[model samples]
Target: MLDKHQAVQSHQKKSSRQKLAKVLLATLPMLTVLGATAGLSSCGFQLRGYDTPMLFDIAKTAVIIEDNRTAFPLKLPLTRRLEALGLDVIDNMTLADIANNSNNVGADPIAAITVNNIRFKRYELVGVLTEIRLVLSADVSYQTIENGKPVTLSNPIQVERSYQYNEASVSTDDQQGNQIRDWLYDTLARRITDQYVAISLPKVAPASANKSSQTLKSPEKTTVIVPSS
Candidate 1:
């Protein structure tokens, strides 16, 4: 009787594992779907049907500097970013080419833009010797060709960053300052790109108008059900 009881206990444990396995198998597909949905949502994935307008519709573009003296740090990164965005950045174009409108090649038009008046300012914090605010400002102008006439759109972009001063460690503070400067350069470059793109893109319709149109097109439907005895 004891041996039989032990055998029954072993069988019960085996059965319990089999039941758990079946349950897991039944819900595995649902768990997988939920996980995939969560991952996609977290990464901000969206369907790709829209065309984002850009400053230079043409494949090639020339970035000219009206005042090259103070824009050295910004020029290289800006050019690289433009190239990364599928623009063929022609750095070899001279100022004369840009001025004469000769940068525009036949059939393949070249968009020319100028960046100037780059300036940097630092302000010390009141009553605090260990902190400073840094400001970077620059002027951007895009030359647009309309009816064989050149039109320019100019805008100013500025970015500010604050850094805490460490009086104890001069080396560390200097290193941090350099890092901040590089960060400022990158931020300014990205802002300049974003401003241009925003200006160039077509204006989108308001959400309320879109909702009204959608409501008019497809009115909501309702269904009613009755219980029978």
Candidate 2:
């Protein structure tokens, strides 16, 4: 009878120990979470900014075809946008430079672009060239290094924008035109970057590897729609 009572007591003690251990084990995670929360709140730290470099194949070269005519304002904005996105822009390099120049005879290139046209249509005041209509067009040619060879990937991205002006609101016209151009440049930049990275970069190893939702970034320049002048 005594032995039975002792065994029962022993089992009860064992069960109590197990329950306490489980409670402790569960408390550990909660304690850890609380500690992290406390530490963050105490520090008062805040996230400021982020960086996302443009993705490309391991090693791909790029060249930009320069626009000779300086009368139009397109290439500069486009080039700036590309550079900001961390692309290897082939500046001061021409199609003749690639084809005619012996230096670029054999190169593993990624992409190239030429500003086919950047014109300002003169919307005349009573048949006079008074108001300017801004239009920008480009031809994008891309190639990728595949199995030790350069494969041509021709993807032309063309965008046109126009603005009507009133002599009374010259400042407004200038501001509106700039905003429109900036937006167009940013859109084109992203399109080209995605294409280049998808084609050139390895599928498994993407340029942007972070799975976080914060990878994609908004353009630096914001466009505010202005009332037509």
Candidate 3:
């Protein structure tokens, strides 16, 4: 009786093994079909598209900060953004510096952006423990030579933000305000970048409707027109 029971138990174990093997064999084709996708997911693959725009790839750009105290810090972030587009960030200090950078890269600057005339305004709020509104405006322009003509381009950007504040949390409110200011400055920089990437090379140096956003070329004495589009 004991030998018969042992034989029966061994048979059951073998059957279980055979079932698992059959299941694996049945799914082998499906697993093979998903092997590549599974490998990508296991390796943490992400499908982010190209970082630089087609027109701005490997182009040289310069960010020139004017004497506006409020806008001085805007140059750094704008330069960083431009460099992220695969542009070579070169200093535009003097002719010698420009020549050195150009010689090293064997290319002239595709565009030169000048930022100035920054304005900041704070409206008086009726309640101190309520919301405060801040406005930031900047004048940005890029000068580029196209078809042997000096062309200057400008775009208008102004960032406004409001946040709730409490007098009890003075430190927190102050910190929040600083962060908001930084964000505003970054927004202004990003707008200039968008304008450059979106607009094609200007054919006749057309300015915008707002004169404050117009950039005039100093390298040549020529006429500049306006274009809203």
Give the number of the best model, judged by lDDT: 1
RMSD of each: 11.0, 24.0, 17.7
Off by over 4 Å in 2: 1-55, 58-60, 70-87, 95-115, 118-135, 160-175, 205-229
Q: How close is candidate 3 to the true structure, as a TM-score?
A: 0.55
Clashes of each: 1, 1, 0
Question: 1-229 in candidate 3: lDDT tens per residue?
Answer: 9999999999999999999999999999999857744543334222234222244432566667775568777878888766655566665664345435545654555556767688888865757676779899877776665654557777767889998777676465477788989988898888887786555332322224233334343345679898889
Give the per-residue lDDT of model 2 (tens digit) for 37-152.
55443432222231333244433244454445532344555555445444556666666554444346464444555444333333333323245555444556665456755476
Say what the RMSD of model 3 is.
17.7
Query: Tens digit of lDDT per residue, candidate 1, span 1-229?
Result: 9999999999999999999999999999999977755654344222233333223444566877654556788878888666555566786675577665554455555666677888889987755457888888888887655555566788888888998876665465477677888888889888876665554443455556677889999999988888998
True-structure lDDT of candidate 3: 0.67
Q: In candidate 3, list every pair of residues with a backbone clash.
A: none
Candidate 1 pairs with clashing backbones: 130-165
Ranking by lDDT: 1, 3, 2
Compute each candidate's TM-score over C-alphas.
0.61, 0.43, 0.55
Error of 3 at 214 (Å): 39
Cα deviation at 37, candidate 3, in Å, is 24
